[model samples]
Each structure stands twice: as structure tokens, then as C-alpha cells.
Target chain A: MPHDHHDHLSPSGHPYRPDQDGPLTYWQAMEIAIRELMVEKGIVTAAQVREQIDAMDARSPAQGAAFVARFWTDPAFRDLALRDGSNACAEMGFEVGPMRLIALENTSRLHNVVVCTLCSCYPRNLLGLPPDWYKSRAYRSRTVREPRKVLAEFGTILPEGVELRVHDSTADMRYIVVPRRPDGTDGWQPDRLAKLVTRDSMIGVAEALPATEAPA
Target chain B: MADFAPGARVRVKAMMPPGHVRTPGYLRGRVGEVERVLGPFPNPEQLAYRRKGDPLDLYRVRFPLGDLWDRDDADTLEAEIYAHWLEPA
Candidate 1:
């Protein structure tokens, strides 16, 4: 009786249905069919698909943090990033693919925030997968209409004198916000400065952590 | 060749065609200035249909928040719009 009772439960003691175990949806079926067809036709091997997936998964906000940290400490590198973001990333050994990259600098007088009103087009190469909220219908529709309100909800309160610039990633170009360097970190090393660069800061939802708040 | 140079005043065409488009609906018919020329790129409208889309010049158009909405601040919104979607303002 005990064994019979446990038979229906998953290892975690809940009756869970994994995606593959459940009935396949239309899109899932299409994907599987196309993948199989491509593999059968020798267009791409299964290993290649998995390798690409792993490559994408390997990218993370840390890459962006490193780039931003370098930008804060090195003037020459900052100029390169401002001139050509894609090339600058490439120089740092990060592959940005074919999509154009633009660095939006946040200054004392200006603030920049990015959103894709149409779809969730992001700089996946540099920042890894986007957070679910970025792709939500609420974010897509509301960011353009009331950006200051949206930013305020994220705890990013801009001063009245600062101008907020919202970039809608509608087409080919991808943007990365170069958050202003925190005060009192003038002589900080790149490695130490990188710890202050959070994913939201690079995305422009927040600012870099102040020197006093730097993690131990 | 590029039709609009940087700082040119351009307006998004007001037409709403039923197909894949990169231009956002809210920007249609709105006026903005060309912040910069992003050079030629393949048209997504044609590429979405699996056709060989000829390249079109792309521009970073900057719109004042007041012009797009009922805001009184100096905030702005910028979007990458293809050449076909813009007309001289």
C-alpha cells in the first residue's frame, strides 16, 4: 500500500508533470518536428543545437559588469565603447554577433532606459537571457507611455532637472546603458568596481551601487 | 543612398499595413528628429516573408516626450526606424 501510494508522486513528493512528460503543445511539436527534419537532412546535428544552447546559457550579466567596470576605470576604453559598442565588446573578447550595439551613457543631466515595445529583442550576447518581466505585456506597453513612473517603480528616482531618455529597441540596434560611476570610487580597480555593476544598472532600471554600499 | 541625414526632421508614416513591421504602432504619424544615421540594413518587412529584402537606411529618431504624450518634462524617446517608415517633416 505504501509503495503504491508513492508510485504516482515525483521524487520531490509532488505530482509534477514535466514539459516533455506532458502533452506537447503545437509550438513544441513544430519545434521537435523541424529539429528532427534538420537532423535527418544533416543540416545540423543534435550536438550542434545543444552546443549553441549551452553557449547562450554561458553568457551572463557578469560579462556586462566587466565591460562597464572597464569603462569606468579606463578613459580610452570608454571612448571606444561610446564610439562603437560592438567593436569595443569584441575587443574585450565578447562576441556580440551581427546586431549593432550602442552604448547609452547616463550623465548628471541625463538618464537612459531601454525597452522593446514591439517584442523582447535584447542584447542576449552580452547580458544573457532577459528577465521575465522584460518580456511581459505590462512592461512592453507601459514603459513607453510612462517611463518615469515605470522607472520609479524600480526605485530609480531621477531628479527634476535630469532628462530621462527611453530607448525603444524596435529594430536592428541593441543598447546597453553605461550607468554613471558612483562617487568616491575614483581610484577603485576594475575588478573591485565591477561588483557595483548589477544587471538592473546596466539595463538602466537602477544606478550603480554607491561606494559606501559596495559589497564586502 | 540615405535620404535623411542626421538632425533631419522626419515623421513616421501613418499607414498601418497588415504585415510584419519593426516600427511601433504608437510612433506612427508622430514627428521626431533624426538623432543619427545607422546606415543600411535589411528590411524586416520583406525578410519576415522569406524574401530577399533589399537594404534600407536606418535612423535613430528622437522624439520629445511632450510630443508623444501629455508630459511637460524634457524627457525623450528614441527608436530605430527604417527609411521606408519615415517622411520629411
Candidate 2:
């Protein structure tokens, strides 16, 4: 499924700043004003802001999928990821910042899903900023109350005997779901397998696609 | 420092102290097992407001999914909770 990448801008791309009386919300205007003031005051340079944005923009689900694929193929790495997710990512050349990263593995009997009930805290260093649905209040409130229904909406149907575990990220920590590898792709290499991993699957909403269904 | 280990029974305190708190309302008074010690970190409740304080032990508490909801869906609900909000059940 195509992900939503909505942005507030006209097709022509003529700049629309809050100061120019465009459609910017009050809070958005205030944020821009404060940011400009901070830049003016030398508290934070505009270059620093751009650098941070660039770093986040450079990240994608591909990085996270690579780790999950590695875990699926390498039992020793899976142990390391489950034991210290942040270190494991670092060992793989991914920096997860100061926040702790926890990798939850999905097995035949148990499945794990992640949500930030209080706020939209996520593992941005690995998966980039969370999708819009993940930050929705409905998702935040419903996932804990009725996780099965939520997963069903995402087109994920668990086996009758399997259990669903919802992980609410409350503090500085972030979680990534290590989805169970699909059958029939037993001898596939990690690169080929990574293509089957989706952002939703890593969030525990859907399962990885089978070899036949995976994209070329 | 964390006082509890995995498999330890812990209950979230039901009280709602006034101020910024990271504890979710639904989990309060709920019983769960310590899934793991998530290590110590700066108290976010204080850090959110720029108040200085010592780091506190954080833990991942796992509760049976069936116990938290009335639905028949079987699963576990695990959340990361600061050690201060938990007590031996």
C-alpha cells in the first residue's frame, strides 16, 4: 500500500509562510516565528536544523528491514538485538541516539504491536518519523483497548491460537517489532528477504508478505 | 537502581499525583510481571519541564492481554514504566 506523504503546499510551490497570510495554522506560525527567532539569537543555527532534517529524511524503513532480516537469518544477532537493541543497531552502523531501542520478536504463539499512548514517540533513527496513522489519537486509544480489531483493520489476521501484545511507549524508549519470517522463503538471502518487510509489519500491524506476493 | 527482576510481580500505584506524569491511566492499579529491567534514565516527568533530578530505573512490565480487556483475543500487553510508579504486588 502506498503511504501517505501529505504536505501543505500548492502544486506550483509558491512559498506560503504564515507571515504571508497563507493557510498556516496559528501554532504552525508561532513555531516558525520562534524558530526564526532562535536562529536569529544564535541559539540554534538554521544549518543545524537542516542537518537534523537531512539525517531524519535519509532514514527509511529499509534500514529497519535490514536489521529484522538479519535477525531472522542470524540467531546470534537475534539474541543480541533482543538483549540490547540500541547496541545491535549501532553494531549495524545505525545510530539510535540516546533513547533506548527495544526489539520485540513475534513468534507463533505471541505477536507484538507498538504504540505511544501519551505522545508520538518512535524510533525515528531507524524507521524515520512515524506514519500519520501511528500518531492518530484513534490509533493511540484503540490499540490498547482493542488491538485485535486494530490489527484486523490493517489487514492482519492472526492465527486463532496466537496472542497479541501491545507495547505502549511511554517514556524515552522506542520499540520495533521483529515480525516472524514467512514460510517457503527458507533459503532466501537477507537482501531478498528485506524486500518483503513492510513498515506496518515492523509495527506489528501486518505480517511480512510471502515470497510469491513480494515485489520484484 | 532497579530492585525487581524479570518474573517479579508488580502492581502500578493507583494514585494520581498532580504534575506531569508519564503513567497511563488505564495501567494504573493493574498487575503485571517485570518483563525486563530497561535500565535507568532521566526522569521524563521532570525532564519535560526542564526540572533537574536523578535518573530512575525503568522497566518493561508485561500483563496478560486477556486481563486488560474483555475481548477473547489472547495476547500480552507490555509497557515501559518507571520503577517509581510500581510496587510489589
lDDT of each: 0.91, 0.87
Give, for candidate 2 chain B, the lowest lDDT window spanning 10 residues.
B65-74
Which residue pairs in candidate 2 collide? A164-B75
A1-216 per-residue lDDT for model 1 (tens digits): 444578767766766565566788999999999999999999999999999999878879888899999998888999999999999999999987779899999999999999999999888888889998899999888888888889999999998999999999999999899899999998899999999998899889899999999998
For A128-213, candidate 2 gives per-residue lDDT tens digits of: 77998999999999999988889989988877788888999988688899998999898999999999999888898988888889
DockQ of each: 0.89, 0.80
Scoring model 1 with DockQ, what do you get? 0.89
The model with the greatest DockQ is 1
lDDT of 2 at A113: 94
User: Which pairs clash in the backbone of model 1?
Assistant: none
TM-score against native, each model: 0.90, 0.87
